[model samples]
Each structure stands twice: as structure tokens, then as C-alpha cells.
Target: MKEALKSFFGLDDESDDDELLSKNLNDDIAIDPDFVMSTDMLLAAIMEAYRVMDRDKDALDLFLTKYEHMHENESLRLMSEKKKKDPSLSSMHSSKEEDKQRLVQSANEALRTFFKMNNDEDARLLFRSLNDSSRTAETYIIMVGGLVEKEPWSGEISQLYQSAVQSKCLTEELAFLAMKSVVFSKLDGKMRVLRDIIADTSSVLNISPEEFNSSRYWQLKRTLGYRFAKLLMWWRNLSSSWEKELKLSVRQLKQGRQGGHVIDEDALRCIVKFAGHNQRDDINQGVPVSDGPSEKDQVIQNKERKYGIKLIREVVVDAHQTTLYNSPAFVDDVAIGFCSLKAYDECIKFVKEMHSRDLIKLKQSTYEHAIYAAEEKKDLKMVDELIRNMEDGCSLNIK
Candidate 1:
């Protein structure tokens, strides 16, 4: 056994480095394969030795080329034939299954070691090279979990997730990890990442919506959609370029929902807030002209503002008509959106519908918007009603 260790590391007993090598190969011990030793155990020891020596890629390569093939169907078949003669061969069949599990465990250990060494390229390559049978979901999860923890802000993690999706190896847990990592990362192009996740989740649901219709799954989609919409707000400026981009974002949201990516209430809230801002910008445009915007620019702002108001009304009406998530917060944003465009009547009507559903506990800002909208419409009765509404559980701070 000592001689095997020496030979494994290209050493000999006559070498002067015996004491140092002894300390390094501490895991190597005398074992009888007939009693307890297995290929996985030996491979693990060698891989650990390789990792300690900073040659983890070699360990991965060894696992890929040799230890993974420990599951030999022909050997199992021969053993089955032998079992006909001797009942003792049943243990051999069980050992074969155990060896397969050990091989998977060994693969996981190698992957974790590669990640520990910061040799992500080799880890990625090793995972990709694995056949479908060898690549268990746990193996994939461990690889991605290591990557995310080691480098949470890396775009490479997102790419690895995409590759897993293409290979059909990305489980729901993996998808959740990838989504969270991407969101937490300071990486650019987050909207694109969200879109990718939406598409991936949609694919899974398309197969068996009933079976896979988990709350956690829908929650992930809702979180992604909300974030995507929040990011869209940065392009809310009335500049020509940003206007086009914002329009594209809105269209993407629509198309996503149409394509089976559920746009939940949280996402609609952000869109409502965005539309409110657009309407406010339009209101600012209508104020006394300055040397700031050209006549053509004012015309464009008016068109975009109209589009924004139209969007908010559509969203509010859709929420009311459909049995969707109509939280009080979402309804608050809807009220503010209508008031921003001085659409007092529409705002009040929607508020009443939501109030009837017990979803209209207005926040301070929404209360202020309602007050201002009623005043703008010269409706004293409406203003008094808003004051009464504020007296009942609504904050009355009008800024």
C-alpha cells in the first residue's frame, strides 16, 4: 500500500522525500477490496490528494475518464447470471447499485473541490461532459450553488444556468437559485435575465401546468416580473430614445403575459407607478412654456402621456374584470395613477369598486392625490368625501 502511494505520486521508497509525502498521503490506508474498498473510495482519496496539490483539474479529469464508468452493465449482467448458481450474488447486485450512488457522490465531491480551487472552468467543463445518467440534479445544484456563493455577481453564473436549461437539467430549485443570484448581482442586463427565467419557467408549466403550478413557482415569476417592471421605470423619461425603450418594455410585458408568463399584481403596480410618472411629466409639459422643450417635443410628450394614461386605465379595468390579485397597495397605485392625469371621475369610480371589495385602504400619497384631483375637478362634494375617507384609517398628511 505504501509502495502504491509512492507510485501514485511518482515517488519511490529510495527517494529522500519520504517523510513529506507520508504526511501528504495521510488518507491512503490499507484496505481489502473484497471486504470494504471500492473504486469510489480510492478515487476520492486520489482526488483529495490532487486537490491538495492544486491539481484539481486533474482530479476532475480522472473522475470523468475512469471512475464514472464504474457502473458496468456487462459486469452486472454476468453477476446476474452467476446469481442463478449462487444466491450470494444478490449482494453483488446491491453493491452495484451502491457503487453507482458512490460514483455520483464522487462526482459531486470533485465538482465541489474544483469550485473550492476557484477552477470554475474545469468544473463547468466536467459538468457538461457528464452524460445524462451521471449528471444528477443534486450535482447540478451543488455546482451552481458553489458558483453563486463564490461569485454572486458574476455573469458566468447566469450563463451556466442557461446551459443547464438547454440541457433540461435545471430543476426548480436551481431556477430559484439562479434567479436570486442574478437579482442580487450587480450585473448589467437584469431585464434580459428575468426574461430568460420567465421563458424557462413557462416551458416547464406548458408541459403540466396543473402539476407544476406551485405557489413557489408562481412567486418566483411574480418577483421576476415585478423587478423587470421596476427596471423599466428608469426609462420613464420623455426623451425620444427612452420613450421608444419604455414602449418596448411595455410591449414585452404584454407579450410575456400573452406567452404564458403570468404578470401578477406586483408587476402591475410598478407599471401603474410608471404611467403615473408619465402623466405627471405630461402635466409638467402643459405648464407655462419655457425655452426647454421644442413644440415638436411637447407634442411627443402629450402623445406619450395619453398612452400612459390609457395604459393605467386598461390595467385597472383588467384587474377589476379578472379575478386577479387586487391588493390594497396595488389599488392605491391605481388611484394615484388616475389622479395624476386629473381623471378624477375614473379615479373615484375605480377606488369605489376596490373599496367595495375591501381593498381600498389608501396611503398618505394616494389620499393627497385624491384630494388634489377632486379640487382640480371643482367638486366640493368629492373633496369632502375624500376627507371623510381619510378620517377612516387613512393618513391625512397632504404635502
Candidate 2:
């Protein structure tokens, strides 16, 4: 037995098995021998070899690889046997909460070992196998935490995040946890992923702009506006020849009647903010006059002829136009003042014109708002028309 053990371990007969075994014991000897090793002698021999080589990692990896495959094969065999016994048994076992928990736990253990080995490629593959949400979440939490701990505030950690996003199997909780892990890393790539996720149209837009501003996504948001503006500003700033032509286009567009249409705070801000001026007073700030024509109209016309577009204004308009435009500043005032005053014709007229001009881009909430406003006014005709127009517009846009 001693000679067989010595040959198995590649150790000399004089070497003490007890001393070597004691040295080879992991800090926590919790793993079952039946699970970690195929036979008692193999376990002792492997441990002895590990002690001789001082290769704890290698031993641990070999043990884990065998353990994982054993469980996986066992699981498959159990599933196959259950299926043969009763096809419904397969479904039953899958649905069993305890089985689900065990699968999740096993997956997590595999992931932990993969990460410990620093085999990122295999770790990612193992993560992909974990399709259950609970298991995926567990794996990501461990992986992300390990990444942050191992390479805190480093670009290498960001690669893991990019991998998660690219995985397509990642859940929101996993994505958020991965994001939170590298929050302090200031990785541009990770920040870009977070921004893209938050901005995903498929998901409900629950992440507010304010929330975006609070997170690492804030840097992205700041640069987004500037980047968008830069495309137009590039030629204007770089080439003197394009400047005059660009100015001409602006003047013509402004002077045109189309200028009065499609005005919103953001669009207006973009126009005015980019069209630089030396003084704040140079920016015409007030509610835009939507009532019967006034001097402001002529000013708009002149500016349009000069710049070729009606520039965005900071002015507050009447509640009627405000509500029509869905401007928040005017939303409450329009609700309280116009609806109570029963200015139904004025409201209906504004809606009809705005709808015809494609000025009021109705979102789900906006459509509901218009319907409620029309109902309160008791103008069934306006409500019906508004609904029809919204439906048609939305359908056309979708198509």
C-alpha cells in the first residue's frame, strides 16, 4: 500500500504521508471526498502531490472541475431517468423550488471556481449556462464583486461589464449590480453601457433624466448635448464660407410661417443656446405670443428673413398654447385657467391646428391628457377628432 501510494503521488517512500496531508489540507475542508475525489487513494495521492509541488491552485482547480462535471452528469442522468419514468416528472422536477434553488447554487459554485482560477473565458461560458434569473443574478453579483475587488477602479473590470451587456442574457438586476460595482471606476466604456441601458426604449422610461444625472451616466449626458450640437457647429466654426450660407438657411427658415409651429422648450433652448450671443439680454426671453399677431410676430419675421428660421424663444405663452405644446411650465396653468374658464372652442381650435401641423406629438400620456381635457370641456366632437388624429398619426409614424 505504501509503495503504491508513493508511486501514485510521485513521492519518495521516506516522505511522510501524514505530514504532507496536513500541509495539503485547505483552510476549509468542507468539500465531500466522494464529490471532490473519485476514490480515497486518489484523493490522498492528489493531496500529496499538491503538497509536494506547493500547487494549491492546481489541486483546487482539478478538484472543482471533476466535482462540477460529476454533478452535471448526475443531474442529466437524474433528469433522463425521471423523464423515462414519467414525462411530466421532468416538468415537475424543473418546477420544484428546491431543485431550482439547487441548480442556482451549483451554478454559483461553478462560477466561483471559474473566477478563482482567473479563467475569464470559461467563467463567461459558465455564466452563459446559468439561464435562471436567480442563478444569473448570483453569478453576476459574485463576478462583479470579485472583479471590483481584484481590479478596483480599473479598465479590466470594465471589460467584464461590456461582456455582460453583450451577453444578451443579463437581467436588469445583474446589469445594475455590474454598473454599481464599477461606479467608482470611472470607466468610459462602462458608463456608455449604463447610458445605453438606461436609454433603451424597449424598457419603460422609469430612469428619469435626474436619476441619470446622479449616476456615472451624468458625464455622458453632459457630453451628449454638446456632441449633438457639434455636428452643426463644426462646419460653421471651421469654415468661414459655410457660415454665411448656414446663416442664410437659418434666416429663411425663421421668417417662414413654419417657424410658429413645432416650438418646444428643448428645441427652443437648443436653437438659442447654440446661436451664441454676447449678452443674456440678446436672447428674447418671454412667453411666445400665440394670440392675434403682435410686434413679436414682425420681430420673428425679420429674424427669419435675416437668419432664415424663427429662433427659439424663452417667453411664456398663454395657457392655451402651453397645454397644446405640453410645456410643463404651462401645463398646470393651462389646466386650472383654461378648463375652468370653459374656453372649449379656443382649446379645440388649438388642438385641430396643432394636430394638422404635426406640432403636437402625442405620447401615450399626452393622448390621455388631451382626451381628459376634451371630456371635461364636454366637446365630444373635439375629443373624437383628437383621438382619431392621434391614432392615425401614431400608426403612420409606426409604419
Candidate 3:
């Protein structure tokens, strides 16, 4: 039987019985008889068996059995050392408090970088990472200070201000500085938020009148008052209550004898004119009626006294010369007041000069009045010369 087996298996002719027995022993335990077994595969098989059997002690025993032989390899030695140091393998949990502290420190460093760069995305991420409220406040202080100093991203300044207000993470000094910066930027949204904050602080903290009057506080107050007045004047088409508030606020502003702050006179005049024009005498008492020879009327009277007769003569001459000849409102206003009382030649010359500059398109009524004045003058020759000059000098579509 042994001779038949040796012929079938291709065994060496000189192989001893012990060698044959050892070969048979390995074959019986082999996982894959067709494949060659490696040292790693054998180790893996032992470890997997121990795992399936829930035999941690066996796993340790098997690992120890092979470790000494594998430890001589540098990669194997390093891997074994790493496994020993691993907390999960050693039944230990790392200190989460220490980990949190490390994370916060990392977040703060990132925040500092964000402030320097003014990278909004990075700043936002750093702010989100901060778990400590005090640290969050400090981070925002640096950010706000940098923003104020640099004025980077001016368009987004309002958004940043809103974020700061919502966070409520700024100190009073920081908030004051932010408010002042908003004024400098002239951002309406930031200004509105600042006003609300000031009003709320005054209401909540019971801040004294003396404190409100302090140099720093009053500077802020004055800024608010002046800005409110300007807003009122510039945004005049707003609701009546808004206009009233603006007037009251402006009156409350600590103005010198001349005026409070550098008021935009153009804006103020437009606001006053708009209000006067829209005033309802029925609803309001003692509304000043603009009568003849009043301040407004005096302005008209002065212009009439100065340029009225001269403008009339020019319009009459221009009307006779060309069908396209038209006079502007200022010229017509002057002509209407004095055309009958003055000569035609002077009025035609004045109208010609005004037409050259293109400043006379004041109103349609003023134009009609000038035409009437020309018809009344009875100076057809002067009117014809005026029209010829206007047709040659001004656009033919003048009316």
C-alpha cells in the first residue's frame, strides 16, 4: 500500500516514514490544499479563529506566539507598537475635555487668520466652531475692529453689522465703535440697527441723562440725530409720520447757532418744498398761506424786476422769425411780468441768450406766458428776428 501511495503522490524514493507522516499531518489541517500557504495567511487564520470563538485570551496567546518571529521586521515592529498604544485595543477612552480644548485653540488660530485676510467664509467657519461664548465674543471683536479699520467689503458691511447684533457678542465699546463705523460707511441698515440698539440700551439699562450726555455717548447721539435728519431730508417721499419724526429728531439735535452738522441744503430745500406743496390746510391748523410779496413771492418779484422786461422783447422777436422758436419758463416768467410795460428788442435779446444756454425749460405755463407776452408787444419785426436767432442757435424742436 505504501509503495502504491508513493507512486501516486510522486514522493522521493529515499523519504523516511517520519517525513511521510509529517506531510500527511499538514495536509489534514490545510485550509486550501490546492493553494500554497504563507506565514501571513497562517497568522490570519489563527487570529480569525480566535475572533470567531470569542477567545480574547486565545487571540493574545496566538499573537504572542508569532510576534517574536515577526518583530524583527521594522514595519511589523512599528505596527505592533502602534497596536499597543491604541486606546480602543487597550480598553481605554481618551480625555474628551482635552480634545475639546485643543479644538478650540485650533479654531481661534483659524479665526486670527480669517481676520487678517477678511475671508468671510473662513471667518464664518471659525465663528461656527467656537464653543466658548467669551472666545466667540473676542473673535468677533477682532473681526469687527479689522473691518472698521480696513473698510473691506463695504457692500457687505451691513450684513456683518446685522450678524454682530444678532450674536450679541460685542462689548459696549465694541458696539459703539461699530456704530461709529457704520455712520462713516453711510449704510442705512447698520444705522437703523444702531438706533434700535441705542434706544433699547437706554430703556433697559436705565442709563442716566448724564451718561447719555457724556462726550462719547453724546458724540454717538449727535451722529444719530444728524443722520436721522439727513435721512428725513433725502428720503422725503416717505410717510408723513416718518417726516414728522425726522423733523422732531432734527429739532432735538444739538445744533449750533448756524446749523447742526453739515446739512445738505439741496436735500433740505427739496424736503421743505415737497412738504409745503402737499400740505393739507383742512387737516392742519394755521398752515402759513403763501400770499403775494411773501418770501417766495419776493424771489419771483426780484427775478421779474431784474430780467422780466428784457426777456419779453427777445421772445416777441423770436416768435415772429420762426415757427419753431420757443422760450423757456424763466424767460417766459420774466416776459409775462413786463412784456406790456417794456420794449420788444431787449426781451428778444435776453431770450436768445437764455436759449443758447438751454436753462429756460422751467414749465409749460411759463412758456405759454412768454408767447402771450410776444403777442401783446406788437413788435413783429423784433419777434421775427428773435425767432430767426433761436432757430439758428437752438434745436428746432424747442418748445
**lDDT tens digits by residue: candidate 1, 169-189:** 778778767776777778788
lDDT of 2: 0.45
Pairs with backbone N, CA or C atoms under 3 Å apart (clashes), candidate 1 = none
Highest TM-score model number = 1
State the lDDT of candidate 2 residue by residue for 1-399, as single tens digits.
434423433334443433333343454454444443444336535544553565544443443444444455546657777568655665555544343344444445545555655655555655555555534445656677656545654565555555555554355555455445545454667545545545541243356533433332223323343332223223345345233333433443354335564333333323333232221222223112232268876665445323312232222231235343554333322322222223334334544555576644544433444565688668798788778877876776576
What is the Cα-based TM-score of model 1? 0.46
Worst 10 residues of 3 by lDDT: 278-287
Model 2 TM: 0.29
| Among all candidates shown, the one with the greatest lDDT | 1
Per-candidate RMSD vs. true structure?
13.1, 19.7, 26.6
lDDT per model vs. reference: 0.59, 0.45, 0.42
- Which prediction has more favorable TM-score, 1 or 2? 1
Instruction: Tell me the TM-score of each prediction against the true structure.
Output: 0.46, 0.29, 0.28
In lDDT terms, how accurate is model 1? 0.59
